[model samples]
Target: MGTQFWVKGTVLCKTGAQVVNATGPELDKFIGKISYGLFHGQRLKQCGLGGRPFRFSFFPSLMEVIPASLHISVIFFCSVLIVFSSVASAFFMYNAFGSPYETLHGPLGLYLWNFICCSCSCLVMILFASEVKFHRLSEKIANYNESTFVYKTYTERFDRSFWIILFTFLSHTLNILLIRLAGIQFPFQEAKEATVNTGASDLMY
Candidate 1:
């Protein structure tokens, strides 16, 4: 039988990677430059994962974004939370007329449930992404033909999942500070507010 083989996967590493073999010193320096940025100073703009930067008039100021990216599920949960809280608040206002004054009860419960669900879902994504193997060029080449399963890098695979989780966590802990500093503006009012008046805004005000 003729030696037959099926080429699999895209030609990523083949793009001059194999041609330019590096020496020990060169390789070491290259590795050092990888820049995890998990704790870097100028690692704000992720380049192109989720949000991109623009000028509202070239205004000079500082903005700190969640270095991470977000998934639909996480984002959806947050959005739903906003909706839930708003509806609940409105419902609370509705009952102020002459009802039991407990109208905030239902929306409050729903918002809580949505918040928990969103949080748990986000956690699951982060854990799952953390477990993902952010391999090197050599590793991908090793499994070049295991299956036609072409996936993005650990970075690309989850589309900034790491940053998403990190930023999301930070947003929770340092929400007020973030707003005050105005370093970066991320939408977290729903989650943050839910944290306090979360007690069913449907009642007081």
Candidate 2:
């Protein structure tokens, strides 16, 4: 949240002068409406979860749903997808129970893999919706946009591997097969050249 210290500071100062030099002076006055904006702007402090300083992505206008100006279709689609994936993972994990313990080799490997993937995917979806920059409680209170704090908290992913490892985690499980239905492929084997007989290929072939 941010404070817009913009007030009509001009008419308070210039009375009739505004009538003659209305264009230039009026523009200056318009700029001065939020003179304190730059002031409060400097008071930025990084507070809460991630510790990275967050100012509002944009100065709040009269709109409350400014940041979420997402098309309902997009929101609805992603929301449904997230919910479906979450439930599917849960159902798969619950149905495909595995060994209670792990060894160097085992039959419950699928179960273990499913458990890992499900856990990681949930963590990632939570983090994907989170932000590293956090809102200071004071700032939120001042700007009246406390929800921004929650936004950052929800989408706080650290890096790509976090997601990759998450899917890789499930790749070992039945969810991997389901994800394959979605056309997602997880790398398992590394491609290698056929003992690239460099000398034989060039000289004999």
Candidate 3:
């Protein structure tokens, strides 16, 4: 995730210094032009109105300047998300193709894995957002090792990658709901109902 800044000022004052206006290229200057991009794994590329576009990595180059602990935590949770997603997939296949056990290998297991992935997805978003917003990530990246004029954030926002993780979290949550809607009772609920039925049968006998 990253931010973009306008290369030039938008407003222009008339000779009387009262009327202000923007026209021509100035009106569309910021359109589809990214000042820079801080992507996941990919190079931090530069593109926009002026200067030659270039690329660089966040690791080793801007490592010290960025929040290492929070960044690493985000990465760690993302990895956990991936691993659990795969585990959930495997369990789904097992449930479909083979005779699975009741507790950990049945529908309950699918719910458990999906819930774990959802938690990991949430953690990834929180940690990354905290590292970005609270840590002033964009400004830090823009001003890293520069002796020139300080760079202020003209615009900042969470990019598509961040939104993708958010969608992943939602997908996991929906998967949980779908599992419940498929008529699979929660493990604890099934146990409690079975206990109640047994008690009622004993009373009748």
The candidate maximizing TM-score is 3
Candidate 2 residue pairs in backbone clash: 6-33, 6-34, 7-33, 129-154, 129-155, 130-154, 130-155, 130-156, 131-152, 131-155
> Which stretches in model 3 have alpha-carbon errors above 4 Å?
1-49, 99-107, 192-205
TM-score of each: 0.27, 0.22, 0.68
lDDT of candidate 2 over 118-203, digit per residue (tens) = 56455434432331123222222223444332211111123343344346445545555654454422233213642333342122
- Which stretch of 10 consecutive residues in model 2 shows the poorest summed lDDT? 30-39
Candidate 2 Cα errors over 4 Å, as ranges: 1-54, 57-74, 98-205
lDDT of each: 0.33, 0.32, 0.57
The better-scoring model by TM-score among 1 and 2 is: 1
- Please report, as a residue range, the 10-residue window in candidate 1 with the lowest summed lDDT: 1-10
Error of 2 at 158 (Å): 9.9
Show how many residue pairs clash in every candidate, following the order shown: 7, 10, 0
TM-score of 3: 0.68
Superposed by TM-score, candidate 1 places the C-alpha of residue 66 at a distance from the truth, in angstroms, of 27
lDDT tens string, model 3, 1-205?
Answer: 2332211112111211222233565433222212333332221222223332334456678789888878777778878898888777766775656643432324346677888999999998888778766887766665566563344444556556667788989998998887777667776667643543333322111
